[model samples]
Target: MKLTSTASRKLAALSLDEIKEAQQEASRQFEEFKARGLSLNMARGKPCVEQLDLALGVLEALHARSEFANSNGDDCRNYGVWNGLPEMRAIFGELLGIPDDLIILGNNSSLQMMFDCISQGYTHGYSGCEPWCRQGDVKFLCPAPGYDRHFAVTEYFGIQMIPVPMLKTGPDMDLIERLVQDETVKGCWCVPKYSNPTGVTFSDETVRRFARLKPAAKDFRIMWDNAYCVHDLTDEPDQLLNIYEECLKHGTEDQVLIFASTSKISFPGAGVAALAASKRNIDDLKLRTTVQTIGSDKLNQLRHVLFLHDADGVRSLMKGHRRILEPKFHIVLDALEQELGGLGIARWSHPHGGYFVNLDVMNGCARQVVALCKEAGVVLTDAGATFPYGADPNDSNIRIAPSFPPEEELREAMELLCIAVRLAATEKLLYERAE
Candidate 1:
């Protein structure tokens, strides 16, 4: 029997014999894929080589020694500007919609900045509050189908993580609002724009609700990670409300810590990272930085400033990225639509921007699907890596990172992945019927 016609039907509607036949066909396909000895990885959202090539000019942007001096006349070779060069701050500030004074440019990884921020809170605490470590039981509200690394940071510090369901608009605000009433809930992690895994931007109402939150802890903060602020895949991209500005209206400016970076736009390892917060919070963090180190890599900062020049320059580079990335994303989405459109076995997000596509398969089958994909040599992110502690209660929600592989490789990977999904779902149904 042709697997396409048979597999296209809902697995639940198939008879026992039909289900077994589908599984057999899937096993046969899986073995063929295994025989190909294909080796492809879709684990992390690293930019493709083509995307990295677009920023090659940046290496040459500072060839001359005289270019070492920033527009503010600070010697890039020196180590005194703890908040980063003014020109670099202004450039990222424009992209982040933050005032230059409110931003502090840091090292290459925004993840580093996030770790530092959490560490600071754990050790020294924010102004007017005791260190979180001393608080006895610290907790954070993590939005599910969220970034695993964010959960990792909180877990590393022994903070209890409370998983909040992510709605179409954003994290369930009502639950978040209720959770924050506990003084132990110190903060929440938010991707805000093109959120990790789910790719759902928080609705305006959700942003407003976040701004108006009256958490019991005076030091409660919102770790607003806008990593994909400019990584749009379409001409019409999602707009995220400025959480800081909204906080200002509600007299809660100190309640949000915003972070962004050029890790994806330029080069992941050598790009610039930054954070934005209220003056009070910035002043506190800046004072702490005085002892952390003399300053970040100013020479690299100068190179980025000279290369990117300004916000428009940043946008131009991103457009080039969108051209290469948009089609790759289409390949993944198109394959899903054609292969599993009405199978009733899976559903996924069609994000306008960001580097990931979230795919949630049949209940209790994500691990099996990921394992099958791995066995076939198409390596995927671990099945439950998107959730807290690497555990998805439903055993669903697989994050697909299509940004790294070349187009042809991505197409082949997706084909194998869809087959794995079909095979896993059929096996699951068969098991349930037998049970």
Candidate 2:
């Protein structure tokens, strides 16, 4: 009973005979390394050429000497107000269903804006308060298997990172509910829709629970990064619960902050990013940002607005992305199915949208598998890069970004990756058999 219990607990742990049989079968297929002429990368979650082709009109509109005036008539080429051009904010606000005044515009990437917000809290803090840099010992709760950049920012500021397990619907709500009780927990990172790597979306109930939570610290915030807000790779888009409405209904309107951007939709390095928050939170945050910078570039925002007028316009763009990207997703999914399906060695998500497809290899084999992929002229997002601190505690999770490369390249790289996974897993099984 004890031996069976141990064996079942770890699919990796097994007897010598079991591993020997696995290796014997695998060794038959291990051809000596051959020189190849392939140079491929399946790493970054960037948009493909065809997907970027959809937004060429935006670039054409922003050509030199155009009507580059803001709603307030500020010249697009010069410094002006800090809150961004009012018309641009209003346009995206309409796109996201929030009032324009509540949104703070930022250049292209929201990461710079988020980093600034967190840094201000570190230096001077929310609303003329004592900076955390002075207080020394600020900490944030990081949902494990989260976006690494989120963890990177908090780590850069010397903040302690507490890892919370991520689930299909969202981060573990029970753990999140209990941990934020401590005053040290300043915030939690979230990607509410079709989360990176895993392709899991937060349920409406999970969103509701998040909005209703009462943290002990008044300064506690939920960094609601909805990067994939409109990124649907399917013909039918899944309806997302309006987080702004949910927070207001649950009496935690002031407790959460929202972020969204048009990077994947329009142009990644050329799109606009915004933050949506309660009036109180906005009032508090603006106190720090208003003085530092003149404002975001109005010309860029205007281009986004002129090109994408409403929510429907934005949704229409996503449908285009879905068409070009869907086949590429199929390429990887089909490869995994043909090579490793029912092999009991690996499993990967067939995401409906978002830039990543998370893969889980047999435990302890991720590193070797990734190495083999590289050796065979394929590059992958590093093994453990998905989890906090660049360490997958389970060492099983691997992020697959299917959006960057062309379908043909993705197919080749994915094929090589599967061969590597099988080889690594079989090697693992054989090692177990020896002992």
Candidate 3:
């Protein structure tokens, strides 16, 4: 049978002979792909060279000697402004919907800030609480198919991670509400807007529920990594309810720590990062920073302030990113639809924004699929990297980072990936049948 005609049928409905034939075809295509010597990567959610080029003007935003000084007349070349420049804080404050006083600008990495937050809690503890290390069996809630780096940070500190299922609206709130009743559950990791891998934006109700949460741990905090707050692909971009705003209404603002960065907006390595929290939390964190370092790179912060100017400038630049990235996402989604839509072996996200396409292949077949893709010269994010401790119990979810590869390479990579998915699915089905 022609694969195109059978493509719409579920694999379970196929006869044994048909399954074998499909497997043979996939193997043939896989070998052909290997012979082509293709070296394409869809591993990390890194911006492409074209996206990077969009920020070329930022490098020259501080070309003159006078430009080194911030709006306050403070020369950015020297240290002293630990809380970052006032104007720089204003830019992030507008973007994040938080007051400038509540925002603490950091280095280029929000991940580093997140780690430091956890580290501080681990080593020194939050106010009125014992250090996390002293608390017997400290735990954290990790929404599954979540950001790997978030899990990595928690894991590095020996924090027990509890995998909460991610729902269409957001993480399983019911489970989180129940889990947080345990005082040992110190915090949770969240990517509320266009969340990593899955691209599931939390609903307004979800945000409200988060704000109203009465966790047993007074020190329970939400690591709100709003990494894709401004990254939109469609004219109708996803709107994430301002968690901080919601928290304030419920008087739970101190429980949420918000993080965002210009890593994707500008240069990834040379961008500015910031954290927003309640005044109490901010003051506590500021005190820690005094001992940590004199200050972050204010010069880079000034460049970002001059370049991005404000929230509107950030939006304009993201539109350019969408233009380049939107097509790439289409390439991956369209291929998956065309090749594996009704195959009953794979399903993936159609993200409006964010840098990854979350794909779930047949259970017990994801690792095999990734391995097959690698052998055929296409690299994908590790199959289990989406979960806590790098373990996906179902072993089905895969993160496809389409931003880094060129369109043609991405197209080729997706084609190979589809074939691998089919081959692995068929092999698993055949083995199960024989058993």
Q: What are the Cα lDDT values of the candidates?
A: 0.92, 0.79, 0.90
- Candidate number with greatest lDDT: 1
Off by more than 4 A, model 1? 6-8
Cα TM-score per model = 0.98, 0.91, 0.98
Ranking by lDDT: 1, 3, 2
Better of 2 and 3 by TM-score: 3
Per residue, candidate 3 scores C-alpha lDDT tens digits across 131-200 of: 9999989999999899999999999999999999998899999999999999999999999989998999
Among all windows of 10 consecutive residues in model 1, the one with the lowest summed lDDT is 1-10
lDDT of 2 by residue, 1-435 (tens): 221223233335445665555555444433433255567888789898888899998877777756677667778778876777676677667766688889988888888778887887787775345777876687888887889889889989998888888887789999989988887778888888888867878888888888888887677778888889888888666566777888888778877778888989898888988898889888877777777766777778777777887567888888898888888889988888777776677878877688888899999989888888787777898998887788888788888998888887888788677767777886877666559
Clashes of each: 0, 1, 0
Per-residue error (Å), model 3, residue 275 = 0.0
Q: Which residue pairs come into collision in candidate 2?
A: 16-433
lDDT of model 2 at position 357 = 87
